[model samples]
Target chain A: MTRLRAAAALALAAPLALAACGGEDDGTVTLRYAFWDDPQRPALEAMIDAFGEDHPDIRIELEQTPWDEYWPGLDSQFAGEAAPDVFWNHVSRFPAYASSGVLLPLTDRIEESGLGTAAYPEDLYASWQFEGDQYGLPKDWDSIAMVYRIDALEAAGIDPSEIDDLEWNPVDGGTYVEFLQKLTVDANGENALSPDFDPENVVQYGAAMASSTGQTDWWNYAVQNGCELQNEPWGDYAVDAPECVEAIQFTADLYNRWGVAVPAEVTNQPNGSLASEQVTAGAAATALDGSWTLGVYRDGLEPGTWAVADNPSGPAGSGTVINGLSNAVYAGTEHPDEAWEFVEFLGSEQAQAIAADLGSVWPGVSSLNGRFADYWAGQGVDVSGFQTAAEGTTTEYPLSLDDAAFSTAALDEFNQVWLGDKDAQAAADAVVAIANE
Target chain B: MARLGTRYPSSTVNALNPVVDPARRTRRDRSTATAYALLAPSLVGFAVFLVLPIAAVFALSLFEWNLLTDPEFVGLRNYRDLAEDERALKSIGNTFYYVLLNIPIQTVLALLLALVLNSKIKGRNVFRVIYVLPWMAMPVALGVIWRWVFDPVNGGLNRFLDLFGVDGASWLNDTAWAMPVVASVNVWQYTGYTMLFFLAGLQAIPAELYEAADVDGASRTHRFFAITLPLLRPAMLFVLVTSVIGSFQVFDTIHVMTAGGPAGSTATLNYQIYLESFTQRSAGYGSMLAVVLFAVIAAITLLQVLLFRKRTVYDFS
Candidate 1:
């Protein structure tokens, strides 16, 4: 009977023993801040120190997941209800996370803190909002620009001045197509426009574009050529619209017909996208990539070797896709007040200065534009072209609750078209169908 | 505890001999209690980690969950949706192709390497370690290196083909070649690991049996078939079952190398499941697909086990 009572006691005591082994609790409130960039860690740490000076009671932990695994990692963390107190969020992914109520709405908190949405760029302020609720505070913004090497153009006997006024039209792609042809050189030292030029033996391509990419390449062309991605934000996809299809066809023809751009096989190789790589390799003269590429080009090239240019004007106008990154408080955070206080500090002038000092991203605060440009100047990269490009017509970065699903379908279908295995129109129709579904 | 034991007296206290050897019965009861106490930790861990998660996934499959949102009950909807999903069907087809491509080549190569390693050769231990090195390397790193090796313009494979006056096709970027290239990387990484198992099986085969075959005027080839092959069936079965499961779940290499592209040529069922669950935020649909995959693997493995049960010689004697 004593043994039986002891056994019963043991059963009851087991859970208590395990429960007693829970995490150690200190007096200070610990807030976890997660982001995906490796190069910006030091700058971010500096920002954290600056925040610590103001709120010494709050301890911050920084979690850095790589770009490819960031979203998947965050999703699993959320599923487990153990997501960080605060995390970096992209505009494209914000809608799904926000709509599902896993992101803490920040409108009332911002009002209480006396910091308005005016901290972010006027255009990007609405990007982090869903259903009239602000779910994120913008951290930084990215816009598309034409990144190029000067020596490659000079070697092809093309004046660098000509590229400044280049225009594109879906009908012939205008002088932009001609510029690509002039810059493209064959193995026999013949230009793409020369009579004896061999597409098979091409040595230098005019540009490199990842066929699977949307934001940095074809989507920009499609929108710039007068096509609406959808009826509205999170509405039905209109990828099969006539203007979009024509734009995509012209984009594909840059490789298949004109042989001025690197083939899909080369551009979308697993190592990295070919544009940034080939520009460094001197195989391609130019690349159309987001402002994010500025740091990559800066780190890769010799000082003054590469320069930025505004994306050439299409018939619609010189248009580009712009998006922003934001710091969002996880809805399940244990320390909401601390997380908000830390996030609030992230948008302040001191933190934006650190972002500028890193030279990786343009600050979300437009007032710091001169500092951002000056940082690039210190690195010997002329970034005025990006500013010029930003001055032109800008399109809203497409965001949807089903962006991943739509992107997967679009990548699969359009890749075939880019590879010359399927018709562009058919691919566009297939993407549209998948998007609607 | 003593009162409880007396209430439910041991079987030793039969009706004819009621109070016989109470001390002995208590000792037996104590040993039995100790046995259960010893097993409790593993039992508790298995219940919490394995059984509960699987049960949760099964329950989750019948609902609509976006990972972040509250789950809504939508019984059988995920399964119904998967039935009509063309991409899902295609991914399953691609996974089967991957399985077929990976298993046979690796098995044959492993057997051959095992045979060579079984012989008394110079630097045998060194060769064994050298062959297994690829398995030790990370999959993501291998994918990146292999991608460069397969590059059409400046890749080592293309450069080698150029020497033979042959034009190299786009290895990973072509729809016809992508799945095979991806599968070949798996074979490259795992064949040596499989060979170690075969080598162990070969070592276990009795030397006396081979001597008997030799004295019976059997040729080397005949002895290999008559003695070595039959005796190695257990190892062969282990390798086959494991490789099949591994092939079906291949994701990291495919993701790093192709990301289910050039087209949808290399998008296997596992990759699709990952995309749906994590990227598309459709955990419920992903769980349904996972259940289907589990069923397929279970049925196939069961069939294999049944087929090999009678054929495998577990005892050398």
Candidate 2:
């Protein structure tokens, strides 16, 4: 009887023991981190490597979803309760995720960890807060600037320095249009100013105005023209103001009326390339792009052939659309402590330095921001213009509770505005109604 | 001859001994049992994969669920919402427009392609494989390549047009051109697939009929109308039914290429469903859209079946 009981117990315990082991017999926790930007992968991998050395009990897995499909895919994953342990979150998406109770409340965790919030930019850091709870830590910052090709400028016989102070008004596009017209070369080797210049068969475009996301394109124009994106934070969209409408019309005229920029057919919503991609491909001479895309240019363009300059001064003076991404922990994450640990590491100055040294983007740690410019200087490209934009006038992308709806609605309406199928004021009103509904 | 409602059409039930009762009945019982056993796996699969999800979608349509929150029973509210939804209505119209543009042209082209390839032409086998290549490719990848080909300024189509001093229109971004461009892509990808069915259907028609036509001194057009056209019904029915259904559910190509834009000209119902479910996080409304899509496709399929049943002969054997 005793012998039989022993055998039975052994049979039952065998599978139990195997199940208990569960692939991590050493007790190492594997945290899945998801992000959308591919260019920032190396810096992120380096952060993972650095984190792993100090905490050998933790391992990290990185998931890279492209920007085009990222939010939609992430929404599905969140709905299915299968979101990554830690993922990059945008300000536009934070309110809905936080309000829906899908984001892990990090206030207690951040407080318990004794991590300093002073290292982060105040607006960006606070943007992730909801209902008196902190949900994310600022990871990086971005400011818009003009990414221009030096050869294109030289060929047009226009000095590159001349673009820094270029001013514009909604009525005539001011000196900015004239400056771009110089760089707009025709197939017959004549610029836009020449009588022989033909807009139909242009060999090279002067500028690329990406009408998809005006954050780095026309939003600056709107903000400089003293237009607010919304009535208030977490409020209805207010881009239908006359100043905002004029700014949008001016941006369109660059492609349609002035014909200096690349046409909307290839540079507007739904099927357009990024402004940075257009400049990198030499389809256009210059584009107003964000600091996050600096690495794309460094890797894409010939070294020392491209340089950055401050955005042109608008009617209300120069302004960059300042935005930043934060590291957010999914509330559904199985390993909450480890996910918190990873986010805390990402927010630290040490990790920020590692990211900064690569010159991919401005570091979240304010003290380390200048190091990003230094790294670019070492690469033979002066990127201080980005710093100037950041230091000078700036505006945040509109804050709202459910920007996913707004973004979809705006893309549909503004696409027509960019295509010249609908007027700016009408498109703005349509988008606002649909989004607010 | 085997008729429609008969059992044991080939006499396989009692091949060795015909004048038996008890033995034959026992064998028949065992055969019926065996047939049930053979069909069990696939029947189970059909119920689980198709029937269950469809039932779930219908149930989901009655709720107000966004996936992140708990579902609330709204009971026909989503349907009510659909009535007022402008985009939803537009998407339905857009899908019909796309099907009208795509199906007829693709079907006629596929038939012609199969007929030509079936003839005694040089390199016909190579042509068969070449035509099917687009069908075999990934639709998303093909959409990307097509986008490059249709780019307004730097596209091959425009550059080609420029050689003759005729500027090509902005094919994918123009409201007038967007639907046609997207529909053309569907036609391009699936025409060869449709052709394969027609080719098989053409081959199945014995050459004896054509020889008989030749003996009667029938013209090519007369033979096609009198014989070839009538005989290819089964394949035509299969291609037309499946192609129309596939065209109605086109999301990947539109998602990758136009994203239902150039001012909502290409926004089909399926794309709108994805937008509502995934982008807007309104899976309840999305499910209602899905149910509507299922009903539309099912009604059309039933219509095709009823139309074909009277004319189709299944027992060519």
Candidate 3:
């Protein structure tokens, strides 16, 4: 009986033996900063190292999760009360995390630190808020544009300068479609404009759009063609508008009817991005992608091969979808003071300038915009198109409760339309039904 | 060194035995204590990792939680909601379809491979290793490679088809073909692993039984049915049970390949549970689905055990 008692006691004490190994009292506070940008990691690390210089008593750890895994990984960590002291927050995801009280409200901290929002765009600053509590400090802003092959356009007997003024309408598709057809080549070496152009044996498409859902693709077209996705921030989704149907139908026709865009079957093969991949491989002449994709393009293609231009103007005029990433602190952080200090430093001129020089994204601080443009120009890539588009009338990617559910449903329904299994109108109705339900 | 007298009656032998040492009871108790001490670590680990989580899943099923907010006690509400959820219902049906597509074909292929390897052939050991190698590779890596192979436009599969004058078809992207493609990939990965068990079972069967069947004027096919198959019941049951459980829990490959897309044709129950919990933040509803899944797997396993209880021939000697 005594031996049995001793065995039971030892068994019960096993986990305690393991637990005792954790959390020794140390004078130095270690803070974990989680973010998802691989290209910007070096700049971020430099910023962190610079912050560590002034405060040697504090150490910062970088937790890099890929974009798709970041949200779920952070959610699980938050559930276990072990989320990083600081992490990147997206505007679309801010509502869910901020409302759940996993994020620390930064309004009071911003005031105490004398970090005024006057230097940031009002919408960008407001994007990280939930119910009037600032939950994020603006990091960077991104907008979409048309990235095209310069040599392909020049070889097609078209002036490269004409790209900036391309226009389109729902019925005629305007000069933009004409330019597309000129660039699109069939296997017989005939351009799409030729009557002999065969869709089945196309060697190169004129343009490509990502098959998946994002503000950078058809959603941008939907808004640019005069569809309102939301009545308010985090409000009802309204994709059933006539303008939305027209925009989606036109985009789908680029693949199914005109055969000028890469098929979804090719574009959505796991990790493949049709727009970027096709353009890089010379399978497509152009892509309508975001400013965030600029680094990838520059890294993959030669500097003189591609150039950026403003997206084609629809009947309603040019429209861009603008979104930003924000730095947010975990509400359950053990080192709130240190985390806030790092987040504050991240918004300062020094960190923003470092981020600007990286040329990966447009720094959220409006004053650093010229510096970013200069950095891109130094790299021999003109980014004036993205800036011009951002300055125009633009739509915000809506922030909603459980946005993933709505977005996933939208992508599933839209994929049917993209595959020619359903019409745009039916898909739009399905998206609206799912969103409303 | 003492021997008990044979003259003593059997009933009184134990009581009258002087050979029993006085410290025997204490020695036995000490050995039992040592055995329990050795078992303690694993028992604690099992309770912590497996038992507690299952209990927590069951408890969470009766509540409404979004993980970020405080859990509210809402008895049976999640289960009730699950009953009406069209997506959840579809995923349940899809999971069954995946199991039906995977198990029989995988088992038959594995058995055939096992049988071929059991025969006298050149480099049979090398072939055995080659067959099991796919199962050893990471599931994530396999899914990635297969996604490229099944790519509709630029994939190797399409290129191979072109050589035969066959028009390439949309594979993973097509709703009709997506589930089958995913099932085939899984079957390809697991067939070798299941083959090892069948090989062991086949080798364990006595050659004398076949000789006896031959003497009874039975042919090879008749001997296989009347002798080989009856003895192979144990391996079949094991393979079927494991394959069903594995099919029910499949998530990573589908997540990487289809992401439960092309109009939700490939969204199995596990994928639905993941979407509900992690993606949608409806952990409570996800727990309900997980509980339902547990109930289903448990019932199926129980049925198989009951059906095989008397049919299995364990006394091969």
Candidate 4:
């Protein structure tokens, strides 16, 4: 009878022992923070340090993953109920994560922190809010801009000042095309603008547009010309709009008809950094890329060779796409308070200024003010155009979770048009069908 | 006889005899049970790891689960979508191209190397080890080293080409050259293993037969065709079928090297399945691709078996 009683006692004690080992302390808290940008690690670490100094009671663990592996890793972690307390989320991917309830709604935190919606640029802030709830705080912002090889333009005997204020109506952008043609010079010392030009032995290119995944502002051009990407938000495919077709055709024609840009066949070469590398190597005159390239090109290229400018205006106006990254607290966090603290610190002006100074990103807060612009100026890059492009003049596109898949399908269809195998109308139709399905 | 004190004690023994036999039966039963107890660990492991997981995957394929929410049953919708998927179709085509490029080239190269090594050469063992070094090297390490060698701008291949005044083309970036480069890398790695099979087949081709062919005024070519070729059919069949299956499932090198890029030029079905499942979070679509890939590999192996059975004879005299 005593042995039976002892066995029951052991059985009861075993579960209590396991429970004690697994449960967290109310006094101490641990938080996990995840992000994809490896280059931003130092700045993030510094911010975490500041957060730690402010909140000594809470400990935060940092998790760094590469961009390609970041999403999948988060998904698995979330499923296992081991998700990080705070994570870096992209606007394009936020909807999917939010819909799945992996992200904690931070509407209350935003209100309590005294950071109003008006504090951020409206579009940039709105991108983090969806479905009547705010899921993230704006972390960093970027915009598309034109980067040019200054020497290449001057050597072609074209004054860069004339094209600086060049405007376009999409219908009457002949001047933009003419400027591009004039800037394009070949091996025989004959410019593309000249009547006696050889297409076979073309040496230098006028412009380069990266149609691949990284920097695609061609959609902005389409939007400026009255092309709707989706039927507002996540409704239906609208890239097949007539104006969108015209815009894509004009972009493709820059390569095929005018011979100013490198053909997609050569430019699409895998692992070939045709845009930045070629521009830096003096093979291409201008490149359409993010303002982030100011740092990359300035550090990579010879001094006094490159400069940044605003994207050329389209039919509607000079519009640019302002892109930003956001930070979210995961729903299944063990230490929700600590995670919120870390996230709030990340949004703090001091952290943003430090991040801006380190050249990590354009700080999301406006109060951080011109620190990033000053950093760019220090690097010998005139970034006033990028700043102008990032202000109220810019537009921010809606990034749904399906954007990656849709973009992949769209680009594949566009490749056929770029190769001249199909026209713009057919390609757009194919892309729409594929994207809808 | 030693304790013969009990003619009356026999009556006492009869009372306890039946109880003693029952106790003996219980002990025998317990020993028999111990044998099954010893086998329980392996049986449990096999059932839990292999059979149960495979069953789970099959059940999971019918649902629309992204490993987040409870799976919602979608019936055959995932499979139906896969059938019309252009990405899956392209991947299947790319996988076939890889197999087509790898099987014939790897088999021939292996057989040729095997023949050369079979010759009466000095330090034959050393040569064999040298040839097999690539097979033994870690695949990831090999991939990184090969990427450096095949780097378009400053690669060893281009430097060598430059020595001959040939303009360096982007080996990995160009769609036309990517698969061939990947296939060549696979061939370089697997040729030695395949060569071992060929070498064994070569050694088994009796010395007496070759001598007899020579006495019959047959040249080396004639002798090889008449003797070595027919006898090595078994090895060739084994190499071809296995290499075809292996090439169809090629993932690691391509993943490390091209990443199914240059606009999805090298995206094989295996790589696509990986991407769809992990990158796109479409496990249902990924499973469908996996099932199709399995069907393709099964069909090819079955075809090879049917074709090779007619040509190969296993009689050893």
TM-score winner among the candidates? Answer: 3
Clashing pairs in 3: none
Clashing pairs in 2: none
Poorest stretch of ten by lDDT in candidate 2 chain A: A4-13
The parts of candidate 2 lying over 4 Å away from their true place are A1-26, B1-49, B313-317
Model 4 lDDT per residue over A329-411, tens place: 98867667678877888877877888988777788887665888787777777777767776635545555656556766676
Worst 10-residue lDDT window, candidate 1 chain B? B1-10
Residue A208's lDDT within candidate 2 is 86
Can you rank all candidates by TM-score, best first?
Answer: 3, 2, 1, 4
Error of 1 at A427 (Å): 1.0
Off by over 4 Å in 1: A1-26, A211-213, A269-271, B1-25, B313-317
Best-to-worst lDDT order? 2, 3, 1, 4
Would you estimate the TM-scores of all the predictions? Answer: 0.91, 0.91, 0.92, 0.81
Error of 3 at B206 (Å): 1.2
lDDT of 3 at B220: 83
Q: What's the TM-score of chain B for every model shown?
A: 0.88, 0.88, 0.90, 0.83
lDDT, candidate 4, B7-31, per-residue tens: 4667677866655578888997898
Give the lowest summed-lDDT range of ten residues in model 4 chain B: B1-10
Off by over 4 Å in 4: A1-32, A54-69, A76-84, A109-118, A168-173, A188-190, A195-203, A211-215, A269-274, A399-401, B1-53, B122-185, B200-218, B230-234, B253-266, B302-312
